[model samples]
Target chain A: MSDTSLTIRRFADLANPTRFLALSARLLPWICWLTAALFGLGLFYALTSAGDYQQGETVRIMYVHVPSAWLAMMTYMVMTLSALGTLVWRHPLADVSARAAMPIGAAFTALALVTGSLWGKPMWGAWWVWDARLTSFFILFLMYLGLIALNRALEDPTRAARLSAILILLGFINIPIIKFSVDWWNTLHQPASVLRMGGSAIDGEFLRPLLLMAGAFTCLFLALHLGAMRNEILRRRVAALRRQAARGALTAGGPA
Target chain B: MSLDAPHIGFVLASYGAALAIILGLILWVLLDGRARRAEIRALEAAGIRRRSDRPVDDARAAGPAP
Candidate 1:
C-alpha cells in the first residue's frame, strides 16, 4: 500500500473501541503532563513578559483571549472533520469525538467572548457592539449549544449522530466569516495581526508569550479531547452492557 | 503584576473567568470519567459481560436461544 493508504488504514483500525481505549489510556497521562508543563512555561512567559506600549497591562489579557479564540475555531474545525468522518467514512469514533468535543468547544468559545468583552470594555469604552467579528463569534457559541441540545433531543443514537453531523457541516460556514469579519467590515475588533497575509505585526516581546500560551491552550484542548473521548467510549460500553443484561433478564423470565 | 494600573480590574476579571471556566471543565471531565469507570467495574463485578467480552461464534449461535 502507498503511504497515504497505510495512514488511512491505521486510522481505520482505531475505530475498534478496544484499540482506541488502549491507545488513549497510554497517551492520556503523557498528554496531561505535557499540558501541565506547557501551561507552567506559558504562564511564566505571559506574566513576566514586557507590557505592551499601547495597551499597557491590559495586553496581558491577550495571552488567554487569543488562545481561547483560536481553540474555539479550531475545535469547531475538529467537529466538522469528525462530522465528515461519520457521514462519509462511517468511522465509529467520529460521532463520539464530535459529541465529546462540543462541551469543550463551547467552554472555549464562552471564554473567548467573555475575555473579549473584558478587553473591549477598557479598549472600546463599551462592553459590546454588534460588530461583524464579535457577532459571528457569538453565533459560533450558539451553534455549539444548538448541536449539544440536538444531540440530547434525539432518542436514537444513530439518528442523533446523523442529524448532528449534518448540522455540524452546515454550521461550519460561520467559521470563515468569523475569521475574516474584521477585514470584511469596519469592526471595532482588530484585524488579523498574528495571522495575516503579510505576516505578524506583533512585537517579538509580546509574540513569544502569545505563542507560548497558544501552545498551552492547544495542549489543554488535546488532553481534554482525548480524555473525553475515552469517557464517551466507556459510557457507550456501559450502555451496551446494560442492554445486554436487560435482554438476558427478559430471556430468563420468559418461556425458556 | 502591579495593583495600581488603570482599568486593571478588567484584566483580573478576564483572567479569573478563563481560569475558572478551564479548571471547571477539567474537573467535570475527570469526575465524569471516574464515575463511568466505577460504574463499569460494578457492572462487571455483578457478572454482566460486555458484548466484546463474549465469544463471537457463541454469541452468534446463542442469539434468540437465550
Candidate 2:
C-alpha cells in the first residue's frame, strides 16, 4: 500500500472509540504527570524571574495571561479541524473531539479575560475596556459558551454534531480577528510580542518564563482534552446501552 | 504573592484566579469520567450489556441490534 493509504488506515484505527479509550487510558497518566511537572517548573521560574523595569511584579501575570489567551485560540483551531472531520470526512470521533474541547476552550478564554482584566487595572488603569482585542476576545468567549449550550440543547447526536460542526466553522472567523485586533485598531491591549512577524520582542528574562508557562499550559490542555474525549466516548456508550436495553425490554415484555 | 512585592494584590489575584480555574477544570473532568463509568457499570449490573461486551458470535447472532 502507498504511504497515504497506510497513514489513512492508522487514522481510521484511532477513529474507533474503543481503541481511543484504550490509547487514552494508557497515555493519560504520563500526560498528567508531565503536565504537573511542567506547571511546577514553569510557576517556579515565573515567580523567581527578575522584575520588569516598568511593569514590576505584575508582569508575572503575563506568564498566565498570555498562555491562556494562546490556548483559547489554539483549542478553537483544534475544534475547527474536528469540525472538518465531522463535515467532510465524516469521522465518528470528530464531533466528540469538538464537543469535548468546548468547555476547555471556554475555560482558557475566561482565564485570559480575567487575567487580562487584572493586568489591565494597574497597567491600563481600567478594569475593563472596549478595545478591539479585548472586545474580540470577549466575543470569542461568548462563542464558546454558545456552542457548548447548543451541544447540550440538541437531543439527537447526529443532528447536534452536524449543526455544531457548521457553527464551529462559522465561529472560526473570530480567531484571526482576535489575533489582529490590536493591530487593526488603537487598542489598550498591546500588539503581538511573542508571536510576531520578525521574532519575539520580549527580553530574555521575561520571555523564558513566559515560554515555559506556555508549554505547561499546552500540556495541561492536551491532558484535559484527552480525558474529555474519553468521557465523551463513555457517554455515547452509556446512551447506546440505554437504547439497547429499551429495545430489549419492548421485545421481551419487561422493564429495562 | 510575595508580601514585600509591589502590586502584590494584582499578581496574587491573577495567579489565584488561574489556579482556581485550572483546579475546577481538572476536578470537573475527573468527576465527569467517574460519573459516566458509574453509569455504565450500573447499566451492566442491571443486565444491560453493551453489544461490544458480548462475545463476537453473540454479537453476530444479535445482528443489527441497536
Candidate 3:
C-alpha cells in the first residue's frame, strides 16, 4: 500500500474503541510519571528562582497562573479539533476525547480565574475587573460549563455528542478574543508576553521556571485526559453489556 | 520563596487554591478510572463478554447470541 493510505489505515484503526482503550492504558502510566517528575522540578524551580525586580515575590504567582491560563485555552483548542473529528470525520473517539476534556478544561479555566484574581488583588488593586481579557476568560469558563450541561441534558448519546460538538465549534470564537483582548482594548490585564509576535518580554530568570511549569501542566492535562477517556470507554462497554443482558432475558422469556 | 514577603498571603493563597484544584482533579480522574476498571472486571467475571474478547468468527454475532 502507498504511504498515504497506510497512514490513513492506521488512523482509522484507532476508531475502534477497544484499540484506543488498550493504547491509552499503555500510555497513561508513563504520562503520569512524567507529569509527577515535571511538576516536582517545576515547583522547585519556580520557588527557588530570583524575585522579579519590578513585581517582586508576587511575580511567583505567574508561574502557576500563566500555565493554567495557557492550558485552559489549549484544552479548548484540543476540544475544537476533536469536535471537527466528530462532525466531519465521524470518528467515534473524537466525541469521547472532547467529552473527556471538558471537565479538565473547566478546572483549568477556574484555576486561571481564581489565581488571576489572587494575583490581581495585589497587582491591579482589585479582586476582579471587567476588562475585555478577564471577561472573555470568564465567558470561556461559562462555555465549558454549558458544554458539560448540554451533554448531560441530552439523553441520546449520539445526538448529545453532535450538539456538543457544534457548541464547541461555535464557542471557539472566544479563544482568539481571550488571546488578543489585551491588544484590542486597553485593559488592566497584561498583553501577551510569552507568545507575542515580536518576542517574549519576560526575563530569562522568570521564563525558565514558567516554561517548566507549563510543561508540567501540559503533562498533567494529558495524563488526566487519557484516564478520563479510558473510563468513558469502559462506561460505554458496561452500558452495552447491560443492554445485551436485558435483551437476552426478554428474548429467552418469549413464547417458549 | 520567602514567606515573610509583604503580600505573601496573596501569593500563598494563589498557590494554595491552584494546588487544591489541580490535585483534586487528578485524584478524581484516578479514582474514576479505577472504579470503572473494577466494574468492567466484575461484568466480565459474570460472563458478559467484551466485544474485543469475542472470537473473530463471532464477528457477526449480536446480543450475546441468546
Candidate 4:
C-alpha cells in the first residue's frame, strides 16, 4: 500500500471498538483522579483563600456560577463544531463527542441557572426575574435540551446527526445574545468584567482561583468526552456484531 | 476562613451543590461505560464459542442439510 493508504489504515484501526475501549480504560483513571484533584483545589481556594470585601461571603458563588456559565457557553461552541464535523467529514468520533458534550453542557447550564438564582436572590432581592441575561440563559438551557431531544428523536444515527446539526447551528444565536444582553439592555446584571475595557473588575485574590477552577472544569470535560466516545464506539460495534450473529443463526437454520 | 462573614452558608451551599452534581455525572459515565463494554465482551465470547463448536469437516457438509 502507498504511504497515504497506510496512514488511512492506521487511523481506521484506532476507530475499532476494542482499540478505543482499551484506550479509554487506560485513560479514564487519570481523568477521574485529575477531576477530583481539581475540584478539591477549587473548593479549598473558593472557601479559604479569599473572601469578598464587598459582597462578603456570598461572593463565593462566583466560583461556581461564573465557571459554569463560561463552560456552558464554551461547551455549546465546541458541540456546534463537533456537529459540523459530523455532517461534513462524517467523522465516526464526531457525533459521539458532540453527544457526550450535551449532558455536560446541560449540567453546566443548569448550574448557571441555579447559582444565578441563588446569587440573584441576595443581590436582586428576588429568587428570579425576567432580566435579559437571565432570560437568555434560560433560553440557552432550553437549547441544550432541544439539541439532546433532536438527537434522540430520530432512529437513524446519520439523520439524527444532520437534524441536530441544524438545530445547534440555529441555536448559536442564543450564545451571542446571552453574552451581549447585559450590555444591550442595561439590565441589573453587571456587564462583562473579565473581557472588558481596562481589566477585570474582580480582585486578583478571587480571580486566580476562579481561572484555575475554569481550567480544571474544562479538562474534566475533555476527559469525560473522550471516555464517552469510547463507550459509544463500543456500543455501535456490539450492535453490529449481534446483527451479524443473528443473520448467521438464521442462515444456519434455513433449508437450501 | 472568615467565620464572621455574612452569607457563609450560601457559599458553602453553592460549592456543595456543584460538587454533588459533578461527582454524580462522573459516576454515571464510568458505570455506563463499564456495563456496555461487559455486554460486548460477553457477546463476542458467545460468537467465538458458536464458531468453535462447528467441525471443520462439516463446513461443506452443513450446506443446507439436504
Off by over 4 Å in 4: A1-27, B48-66
TM-score ranking, high to low: 2, 1, 3, 4
Model 3 share of native interface contacts: 0.84
Give the Cα error of residue A219 in candidate 1, in Å: 0.6
**DockQ for all models:** 0.77, 0.78, 0.78, 0.46
Tens-place lDDT digits, model 1, residues A1-256? 8999999889888999899989988998898888888889888988888777778899999999999999999999999999999999999999999999999999999999999999999899999999899999999999999999999999899999999999999999999999999989999998899998889999898898899889889999999999899999989988988988888799889975
- The clash tally of candidate 3 reads 0
The worst-scoring run of ten residues by lDDT in candidate 3 chain A lies at: A243-252
Q: What clash pairs does model 3 have?
A: none
Residue pairs clashing in model 4 are none
CAPRI-wise, candidate 4 is acceptable
Better of 2 and 4 by lDDT: 2
Per-residue lDDT over A1-256 for candidate 2, one digit per residue giving the tens place of the 0 to 100 score: 9999999899999988999989989998998898888898899899998888898889999999999999999999999999999999999999999999999999999999999999999998898989899999999999999999999999999999999999999999999999999888898888999888899999998998898899999999999999999999999999988998888889889655
TM-score of chain B of 1: 0.77
Q: Which candidate number maximizes lDDT?
A: 2
Interface RMSD of 1: 0.8
Cα error, residue B23 of model 1, in Å, equals 0.8
Ranking by lDDT: 2, 1, 3, 4
TM-score of chain B of 3: 0.77
Decoy 4 TM-score against native: 0.85
Q: What lDDT tens digits, residue by residue, belong to model 3 across residues A18-37?
A: 78878888998899899999
